[model samples]
Target: MTHILQIDSSPRLERSHSRALASAFLEQWKPYHPGAIITHRDLVRDPVPYLDATWITAKFTAAAAIALSDELVDEFLAADCYVLSAPMYNFGIPAVLKSYIDYIVRPKRTFAVTENGFKGLITHKKMILVQARGSDFRYGSAYASMNFQEPYLKTVFGFIGITDIEVINANRLNTELRDQELAAARTTIQALAATW
Candidate 1:
């Protein structure tokens, strides 16, 4: 059975374009895969704890390994796919989403160092990122210089073996091109939903 992990990071409920797109994607996906199980995590409503001294210590020191906890590990490993809704904040991902990443990307838990260097623990998983931005940042566009969200997400998730990532960007939310960007994002989501 396919188990999907859905995470929404937008603080705004009704006003968030990313959340709306993600909801649509989920609604569309459910009918196609009727037996698929979904696990939802709302980062904005229930914020994840940022990494602190204890988390840092537990990560580096092999002595305090029990502090890492198996529950957290199990939660992540339970999913076969992930759907994330995130909005660009200050040219990057929101703080809440970053905090959630920090919680899940644990050393010796999600990744490990092998004889051939570092290897990602979570493998053969697929991911979809619904990114909402206030400005245009499509490839080769003028505002593309400011696009850090997509690349950053790709890099981080790739490090954890989630290389099969599809990004549907709802850009230019604060610009005159809002409607156009949203339309393009919707098209992309529909295409991805059909194949994913």
Candidate 2:
């Protein structure tokens, strides 16, 4: 059975737009792929610890010598696909999500630094990010220049070898156009759920 890793990073709980979109997608996806395994990781409820001296040292150490936090790493590696639900905070991803990224982007595990450049060890995996932003950040929008969320996520995930990334942006959540934005997002979610 295919395994899907679902990660929810919004701290707003039930009121979070990204969470709603993610849930909608998952609900549609289940019927399409019966017997698929879904693993949910709620960062707000159980946050991953920040990487410090010990973690950093362990990261550089040889696999035989150090006991890495392999549980999260293993979960990430085992997944055939991923659904990340996040709210844009300060024009970037939430701290809890970033912390989870730090944990999964391991050296020699998820990526390797070759003589030429960095190469991503991960392959053939797809990722879907459901982002809820307070303002419009789509290309050609007035505030697109201020959007660090999508770009940062793309860069970091690309560095780790996940290039087949799709983003479903629910923009302008704090604006007067909130309802319209959500409706559009729901439409997009329905389409992706049908195909993805």
Candidate 3:
């Protein structure tokens, strides 16, 4: 069975647009893959701890060189796909979400050094990022220059071998263009849900 890890980063519960979009995506995805197992992680409600000296030392040490904890390695390997709902905060991801990333992207775990430069250990995994922003950042728009969330996520997740990543952005949440942007995002979500 397929395993999907759903992560929500917004502190706002019902008011969060990203969470709404992700819920819609899951509703659509369920029927298509009835056997899929879903695991939910609400970062805002239950925050992940930031990395510290122990985690750093564990990450850098060889897989066989140090006695690594099974809990740490199991968390990274437990999913076949991830659905992340993140709202753009100050032109980037929220601090809580960033902390979760710091905890998961461990060396000799999620990734490792190889003879061909560096290689990510996690493979054949898909990721879907649902982003909500206060300003419109669609291509060719003036506010497009302000978008950093998508690119940053792409870079970081790519580093861990999550190349099959897709983003559905719900932009202009607090602006005059809110309704139009949301409609567009919903349409995109519908299409992606059909094919993804």
Please state every model's RMSD to the true fold in angstroms.
Answer: 1.8, 1.5, 2.6
Model 1: residue 123 alpha-carbon error in angstroms: 0.9
* Model 3 global lDDT (CA atoms, 0 to 1): 0.84
lDDT of 1: 0.84
* Model 2, backbone clash pairs (residues 3+ apart or across chains), number: 0
Model 3 stretches with alpha carbons more than 4 Å out:
62-73
Best by TM-score: 2
Q: Which pairs clash in model 3?
A: none
The candidate that wins on lDDT is 2
Question: lDDT of model 2 at residue 111?
Answer: 94
Ranking by TM-score: 2, 1, 3
Residues 1-196, candidate 2, lDDT per residue (tens digit)?
A: 8899999999999988999999999998899999999999999998988888767877787544234357788988999899999999998999999999988888888999999999998899999989999888888999899999999998988898999998899988899999999999888888998899
Task: Write model 1 residue lDDT over 1-196, tens digit each, in one string.
Answer: 8999888999998899999999889888888898999988888887866777776777677556444345545777899999999999887899988877876776777888889987888899999999998877889999787888888999888887889998888878999989998888888878888889
How many clashes (backbone atoms < 3 Å, residues ≥3 apart in a chain or on different chains) does model 1 have?
0
Using alpha carbons, what is the TM-score of model 3? 0.90
